[model samples]
Target: MKLKKIGASILAMAMATSMLAGCGEAQTEAPAEAQSTEATETPAAETSAATEEASATTEAKNIEATEITFWHAMNGNLETVLTEITDEFNNSNEYGIKVTLVNQGGYSDLQTKLQASAAADALPDVAQAYNNWLTPYLDKVVHLDDFVANDFDNWDDVVEAYRDECSEFGFVHAVPYNKSTYVLFYNKTMFDELGIEVPKTWADVETAAKTVYDAKGISFIGFDDLAGVVEASLHQNGVDYVDATGALFNNDKGLETFTYLSNLYNNEYARLVGEDGYFSNVLSNQQIASYVGSSAGVSYIKAEGWELGVAPLPGNVNKAANMAGTNIVMFAQDSNKQLAAWEYLKYITSTEAMTKWAVGTGYLPIRQSSYETDEYKAYMAENVCAAACYEQAKDFFFSPTFDASNDIRNTVPGVVEQLVFDKADAQTWLDTLTEQINAQY
Candidate 1:
């Protein structure tokens, strides 16, 4: 899929008008309290005595037949797979609970819907979301502590990176479903032809890029000079983007980070690829031998018939740090609705579901159990290149969690773009941008 770039102008306007506080909590009130909280502890309440008598609904039957509304951002084949999971959940048990699935388009589109729904107090019981978007909605969403304690898996069972981003408010409003990381993708065929081994560090990657450019008439990578991607590279180099007080983009590490990238553009080993056509085209043709991007890009790379290999993003100090994939959250607080949402969340994130989601799309499986499952392991065994992505998960970063002042984030890309196209001074650019971003922090 072609990832759309929000225009610089629009992002600038968004930064101006948008809250620095990340996502704003949906301007909505919680549902009225239940008169009898006891009803929450009992699934028996879903069935009436007369109705039970009429149908002779057994415990097994009720367990096999429950239904709930689920909203997601999947489309095409990805959408079909999610629907299949919902169908399986509805069929596997006697509980009458059925999941009514809704496709809400992409993440940004889903965010807009959630914002509107939250404002109107009509959020779907469960909805898909990213970590940044969830921060602002925390006040309105139902905390899953009580549910997790009383019912299924608890927070400690999840990955530490996910737990760190979500453990606030004493409850997890979201669950890590399709976790992902960033890695460097290189053309294995090109590497062999160049007689160069795969790059393991930023220095090695940069040297290889220059070699490829010198030997062949091709650029080694297509860099869009984007913000989020650059930040991932910076953080991987031991740069703490935010301290207890706020943004830290102007520090020695941050400047050193962009200075390295500026050197790439200065040397002409990397060039900005436009958002439209020819971006993926050049990469697939091996005109660019390496690209640093999300692990989720694996599916597209494979489908295009490119021989691919991956490595933990080349780091100056550590391994790699990247933003993980989005999280799923709930905004409606009706006890019954939250319970139903929890069931769907649990059902969708089971080892089975995680495996299916990962294979169907290039999303990483969030559950440890899923990684051990036969189906997932088989896929992994076949795709040795994909291992780099999973291996780098240890160093991944969640974006909004560290973007408190939102200054570095809003400025870094512009600085990098200028350095790339305008031959801007790295020290001056870094100093000015740092001052602006740190002021907000």
Candidate 2:
């Protein structure tokens, strides 16, 4: 999917304007209380009949379900799979609730619309959101902790890391919907011809790069996005880019990551797709040996002449992959609508639904039980690349959650560009960028 980048300043301005407007309230006077009457003054049979009638009325009201709106950004095959599952939910449920799906283009467009809706108090019943992007609107979203504890039956089956990813400040604000991680996509033909082993660490990657260059006279690897490389590198080295206070990527670990990438780029061993164009073209043409990218991107990879191999990304200090994808959050609305939304959310994440999702799309299933199913195992046997994604799920980590997260993501490419093209010192550029990012806080 094409991820659209939005300016953090614009998002902040919209949120701020909405918050100020949301604070206004109207006051009303209370009516005077009437004198209390004794219950014994009423006839016993009349009271019983009145109580039965009220109970029946309440039951009828409870049974009358509401139609809720769900906003999403899925398209193509992803959209197809979601539509099928949604239809199943609508048809199988006993409740009178019905879900209407709305596609707001891609994730970026969805976020843009969501912000505007917040400003106008016109948000949908449920929407797709990233953890950091949704943090600012926590007040407008329903915390799912109480619902999970009381209603959801599959809470314990969810992966621990994913569960934590959906929570913030001790409350569950969202649930994992479509989740993915990074993996290495290599050309097996090139590896066998050059007698190179699959890379398991940064050192191994460097060695393989040198081997491929010496043998084929082309770039060894191509990065679809430099910012992703930077993020993964820092994570592998146990460095935090952002936290509660501010940017943390100006330190030793960050410098090491930038310097390593800079050396690779400076030496012509690796090329960023921003400069070299698409990885699919480069890999198929044998211009580069391999590239590390999102597991969900596996569908875009096309190898014409050789077998494609997918594996976990090489680690330096530790094994880590940046978790990529959005979560499903319910908007704060009427109780009936909220309950209906929760039912839909829970249904999609169920074992059967997630199994179908994982098999239909390359997205990782949120529930551990989804992996143990025979259907999923059969699917994995056919698609090895997707299996690698499931293997790396245990080590997946999320980016920082803050109001300025989009700003931080936007700033990453500049730092990488300076390091790769301008030949700027890693520490110096990182320090400057860190200060700029911290200023947003």
Candidate 3:
């Protein structure tokens, strides 16, 4: 059962005041309500130390290492890079543990397998996880505190925000594996034909979109209008999804972002594509001058045979983009397996593995150490068009999906769809929609 706060308090009170409140009582009195808060209140430092000691004790057992499963979603060219790294680990590591990498379909399929594994006590030692799924798995997963303390190279120097997100459960659930951000893919031929300069700001994007539209009578760009895109826009504008109390995306800036997208839809500057390769079809036909999509789309964009220009996602207030894809999570596996899994995690996050991964696939590397290496720098220089995505790495934030984030994802698109159809005023529709979303969450 889910751990309800009220039930926890009552449980604590029963332990603390059991002597005072008799044995026969079903609904006991709240006798001075001084429940033990210790388990939940120990500082993060103490918790880290305790977890380290626990890991050390497990290591001390000297149990024979066994084979462990490692579930992931590295399809297409990306799959080759992951296998290369895994093979290196399997062949060279002195540790007796063996990891069998399993491809478990896409992100949604992985989540389904994870939940079933949790129920059957069959979870792999390490599995791929999305950020939204990380929260609920906190208690059931192994934190990386011990792993980092023992084997991490310059691990402490990771950016504070990125580290904190990974370590919020008092242990690092997963190391930041791959990083990605949004970029505007423009038609270089079209831009040159119209004499339009590449845009670096929101005003520039609007002007260019309008210019291309007026000149060619085609929508300059298309956005998915998915919550990921909306969250990116809002975050770039310095808006957050939560505040001191709880959820806070239903705010003024958020409403304004919604309104702005609606205005674009109404004016024909940006249009949303229907499912079933709608955006891809538009791109192939050259009906859209630009498309803002995931950096992971690099390979697919190249295959479409259209010359592409990749530019940093434009921002009105600040530079930011919502991170997409998944993270690597080592679940509550055997202690020996956990350490071995961590060894693999650390090895893959190193500069060598990162370069191979990026070159094979389109994923951006996660470590600052990556950028310092000549190989990564050379790769970036070789593909200068992707520099905007590389530079925006520092500005990556969690996408809008929280525990109940699906609510926002499902609802926000409908609100925009309504506004695009001109069924309601943009601001009015968003305000009401945000309230409904908050309530659902």
Candidate 4:
């Protein structure tokens, strides 16, 4: 949709003029979209009851604004599905709200646009953002604690890990949307032919990789995300790769984990998905025995005459995996626009909508109940990749988000690159990595 392009001052002035001219107009307040109050636990059904009561009392108030803008990075099939849902909302909502979607090409482009728009006080009513990307807009984004409390009867249905990440600043400010976690994809036919069982632990992974290498004289395991392995491996081994105190991967635990990973790569037991891109083709062609990558990549794994398998990431002291994706961040706006955005968020995240989204995009549904939906169950029966994602959903953890989070995140894989490819000293490279990440603070 073309931007309305009205200056903030002019919009405010027009609102004032309309208010002045409506001195004798009949007035009926709109249904309270959300009651302002401190965050508190309330029965999930209370919100639906409140909306019903509000609707029964009177017609909605006369607000001159009924249109809201949404900005996102979704494209191709993702964009088509999102647009279809929004069109459904526009055609059916009784609130007379029309949501105009503006696709900003890609995530990086969307982030740059959102930053510029926030600086100019022209942010859209809603946009997609990652936890780290939200630092710049905290003051201008709505504190969604009250909205979640008052507007969602099925709020608890949302995944707990996503809930933890959304509550970044003491209260919820964003809602989970496109979410996915790391999973291990393997060649089921190869594993069975080799008499190898699926790995469930980190040590098992090492043995399996080494077993394949010894038997075939070729590295059969590939990790698409080196930094992800570093984080989740260390996390499961009792060390946070990063936290509020900054990078923690240079310690004793880091040494052991880093060394373990370096041996896998340097010894030619595993390969990294560097500039060569994804491991999908390699795994499908039986050039590799297994690979670790995002659950969202399920749709990309075109298995050719080979049975594929997916399972949660192998664990150590604890079973854990890292989550990645965007959430819907509602920018601060007038009550009417905010209400419209809130309802739109609710609509998109509902079990029905999320089921379609997961099947359409390969992203995990944000709600637990979505997995139980008939559509989702049927989809999972056909594709087990999503089922593995759901199995590990409760164990997923997001990194502590800050402006420097992505920079530090980007740096870790670089360290892994040097360790594996350059064959650098593990301790020296880790110490340098730690120092570099610390300097970002």
Candidate 5:
């Protein structure tokens, strides 16, 4: 069930009124009025050793060697980097918190396992989670604020957008990790040869694509992540996907966006992701001059003979783009293990550690201080184009990701496919989908 304020209040009241029952038992149970957050909010508590009463509340402050399991879907290079960091945390933590990394194959596999584990009440101490996918486990997850709120490297230190993203559960139930924003990967050699400047807006994008396509007689620009592009474009132009009443994108701005992009594709100014699933795979091919994709796709850029340039996402009235990533959530399990997980989270988000993660993977650094650190600045300098995501970081925004968010999000791909591939009248499909979403709501 979707968690509302009242649903969360009882869980909050129970924990606020009680203390930890013991080390390895289920946390102090809340009253029925304080219904546990199942796919609800989350569980949490705090303790300080300065006083006995404070000590009674915050037992996590105690030092204990704890072994915790962390389940994730990261694999390949991403997995290597995360594992490196996990090793660092396990070795460096003063308390004996040994974090065991378990790769649950792809995201689907991880989600499947997490659901089964949640059902069996055999959840790991910590797991990586997406905001939309985390609701059902709310009552089972531990809210991090009360336990780690006052830490120096906690929420306040995170980028404003990331901090807002992690608060989707109405509380700090997750920590921002391995996050990225979209970027325009352009061929500098192609741009220089064509005498086109980097695009500053969607209108500029059309002009640049037309110039390149006209000169080469090949569809020049392809945009990956069609779902995010379309949704973010609407909001950037001051349109909402939905409002209190229903879907709000049936207006002039929405029609204008779809129509504009449709014409761009029909005129052969845009390229679809062709036989290859990702447009990035074809960047080395001469016909493809540029594509807009995730900054993390920097790892996939293989334009051997040409100079690659990265630019912040093309915007409209507002410099807006979507934030894409997952967060690490501590499940409601052993109190000591919860505390160990908190320390590990705190440690990873530290300036040096976050910088290492950002450098190893193409993901953006999560901490404000990480951006200012010498290592990160030097990394961004050598790989100058990689800075585009950070340039548009402040403009990053989230969709209204709540109960019906996934179903709402799923409707966009069909809308995008029709617009890009079939040149369908976007307003018609948008009208249909908006109503469909409202009905689902």
Candidate 6:
């Protein structure tokens, strides 16, 4: 809720007058893997131009103009950007395909309404969902492999990590839309005054925290989400959170991550977010020197007098971060509406449109080409806060998708809270939590 609340406030203030509206491996070879999964059938050598033209003509005739509804959880400035993008798509197309935008409050609200609609056989044409959230509704959703094979020409341009997340069993079930990753936001003023360099590794973080606390008597770092920190630490150490068999967070690497964070908190070098629940205010007031949070949180961080700096999260065994955000999934519908929805989906994810989306909102562009575009480069040049996120985009991973994903994700905070506040034994708590998660599987 703190994430949503802070983002909403900053987005609303800027809008005032205008709108109302893979856990797998290290993923080093993701691009090649993604390309291999795409359908690659091509016309034969003897195929003529006439044959191609006729096939195109026949396919065009099969698709009919229709209105398709899109349900999303974006609000405030995000909704405003979505409206503009959707309107542009609607206006540019020659087909009379109209996309209706529906805001379903937040992600949780959207999930509830989506489930209810599915039970009633009244799902929308398309909706936004996290990869894990699609597990229960796979039967009702359209796999995009055929669509990508025939229609989408820029399939290779999508970021590899995102492409992998949208795929399951060598098939793409969704398209990455709003995507982001974690970054370290720190106070440059404090770092410079205290003779502490920007942290580039876990050891650097410890040294900086100790230096700051010794000199100024303030907690050096505060994590908005303890689970997120734990996950990132595990990934940096080359460990998975879960797999086909069971939870892997109780392994030796997991214990090391827990011990690291516990030591930080116990030694007064770091703290979890407090009751006020806004790190921007905490940082601006000089209560803490830095925090690890989403890249989309740039608008929420207000370091008035001090120069705010953003960097990739410090690495331990390796440099890594957690990928966050949702994908656009089309629900099963009549051919006409499905075609219309696919057209809208392709249009929105196009390089030109996604450039606008990424620049307008703080979210990263899913397309690799979007990053090379002049517009995105200009925006990045002006707004340096998001540069590190984009730079570290390739070095990120997603949690494995499973039936108990939401439940498993929800269990983390309680386990982490016990470690941070109650001084619970790390190995015992993790072992118990691992058992509970394995039971769900």
lDDT of 2 by residue, 205-247 (tens): 8899888888888878876655566666777777766665786
Residues 260-329, model 1: lDDT tens digits:
7777777877777655332344566666887765555444443155466666677778664454455777
Error of 1 at 357 (Å): 2.3
Candidate 1, superposed: residue stretches over 4 Å from native: 1-67, 153-157, 223-225, 243-245, 277-279, 302-306, 399-415, 435-441
Against the hidden true structure, what lDDT does model 6 obtain? 0.68
Q: State which candidate has the highest lDDT.
A: 6
Instruction: Give the alpha carbon lDDT tens digit for every residue of 107-170 in model 3.
Output: 5577778888777867788887754554444456676766777667777544344565565445
Clashes found in each candidate (C-alpha, N, C closer than 3 A) = 16, 0, 0, 0, 7, 1
Better of 3 and 4 by lDDT: 4
lDDT of 5 by residue, 87-120 (tens): 9998888888898999897665777799899889
TM-score between model 6 and native = 0.84
Worst 10 residues of 3 by lDDT: 29-38
Task: State the lDDT of candidate 4 residue by residue for 1-441, as single tens digits.
Answer: 000111233223222221110000001110010001111121122122212222211334443438889998777677888899999888988778899999897777887899899899899999988766666656776767767876675787786666766775666778988776678888888888888889998788788888889888767678776666776788777776665467777778888776767677777888866655677667766778988876666556667887878878888877777777778888877666767777788899998888888777767777767766777656656666655665665566655665566566556666677667776565766676678778877
Best by TM-score, which number?
6
TM-score of each: 0.78, 0.83, 0.81, 0.82, 0.84, 0.84
lDDT of 6 at 206: 91
How many angstroms is residue 173 displaced in model 1 relative to the true structure, after the best TM-score fit? 1.6
Clashing pairs in 5: 37-139, 39-135, 39-136, 39-137, 39-138, 46-58, 47-58
Candidate 2 residue 246 Cα shift, in angstroms, is: 2.1
Off by over 4 Å in 5: 1-60, 152-154, 243-245
Better of 3 and 6 by lDDT: 6
Say which prediction, candidate 4 or candidate 6, comes out ahead on lDDT: 6
